[model samples]
Target: MAAPIDRPGARWGVAMCHGFSGSPSSVAPWAKGLAARGFDVEVPRLPGHGTDWRDLEGRRWREWTECFEEACARVAARNDVVFLAGLSMGGAIALRTASRLPVAGVAVVNPGLGFYDWRVRYIGAIRHFLRTTAPIDEPAAPEPVGDEGDYPVTPLAAVYELRQLFRATDRALPKVTAPLLAFKSDADPVVPPSSMTRILRRVASDDVEFVPLHESPHVATRDREALLIVARTAEFFERCAAKAAHPAVGA
Candidate 1:
């Protein structure tokens, strides 16, 4: 794991997670943006990420979830309030963490809770013959979007493992109580629209808010609405932290 971006002097902490096969660079901007506001931030690079795609071949979903939990624990220890944010697959990891942890809030951008394509369901059956596929990165945005340092190819076994993670996360959704802010892109090419709907339907969180992004793709953090993501996340964190500190006087 790369050194996490830590900023001192804040009682609140925010832990950000990147997408599957992607490095911390994917969430670096949002992490830094939170840090700039004086909140301690940690963005841990998951196992097999920031390296060759082959390195990610056999890793399981448990490993990724474990890493995310550990990262959240580290931040929770030092801060009175903690918020978790993630992109794509990382959103599933964040949701899993929120289900188990005492987090103040969670923000998921284009969370990959389910796939619209039926072909992804067959990864386990064909992994023995087809080990990997072409790079999953989408075409460049009209503007220069920085590279997220993701793997060049998608690992078949890893994809299967992600499916497992999604199932596990879905099972745990009703246990989650933390306030949730889900950002869905109207034109996302990677994650299906059902991904966000699944979360809304299952999670027990009463304080849920959904924001629709009209322009961004699956990687909203790097899209044209990137700054909006940062601002909304920061605001959501602040509101949740406040609510945690001062619950409504009555009832």
Candidate 2:
């Protein structure tokens, strides 16, 4: 994990999260962009990640949340306002964090709310016999800018834990009141469109923006519209954080 990156401006903070298997590098570009715009950016490594798949074998989703929450607490204590942003599984974690923490806003890209494959549901049935993890066959991305920080494989045990996290996120959705932003790739192969719809329908956040990406794949943060994502996310955080700090002159 990288040390906390900060730039002196506005007393604001943004906690950026990478995907389930990825390292800080997954969200690094966005973090740097936000940091350059004067928001302190903290990109923490997810538990059992950035090392190897075996390390993640028996890890639970609670550990992931605990790791991210501790980082969020640190950011919240330093800045007057704080926001959460994440990609893939991190997106789900950010939403879960928003439900618990008093952050100003939340943003996500291609969040993995559920798997696109039918076989994923059966992982639990075969866990005892399979013991280890196996890769699923999928078509390649046309314009792949892979998450270099990611593990090549995912443990079946981790998949079960991730499923639990998604279920918990669904239950906690109505509790999230912060402003929200989401970027969904029209043709994401990893996560389905249902993920975004789930948030729009479930979250209590009245301030929400759902941006559709036509030219990007699952890793939109590092894809063709990568710069666009950075620009839009930074703008959302700025506007929402300002709105949070200074409300309208009252009714």
lDDT of 1 by residue, 1-251 (tens): 12323434439988889998998888777787777777789998888888888889968889898998999989989888899999999999999999888999999999998876688888789788898887555656566457778776889898899899999999999998899999999988788898788899999999999999998777778878888888888888888877987799892
lDDT of each: 0.86, 0.83
**Can you write out model 2's per-residue Cα lDDT over 127-178, one digit (the tens) per residue?**
6677565454344445555555666777788888888899899999999999
Candidate 1, 153: how far from true, in Å?
A: 1.1
Query: How many steric clashes between backbone atoms does each model show?
Result: 0, 0
Candidate 1: Cα lDDT at 17:
90
Candidate 2 wrong stretches, greater than 4 Å: 1-9, 133-147, 249-251
Compared to the true structure, candidate 2 yields what TM-score? 0.90
Mark the regions of model 1 whose C-alpha exceeds 4 Å error after superposition. 1-10
Q: Residue 199 of model 2: what lDDT?
A: 84
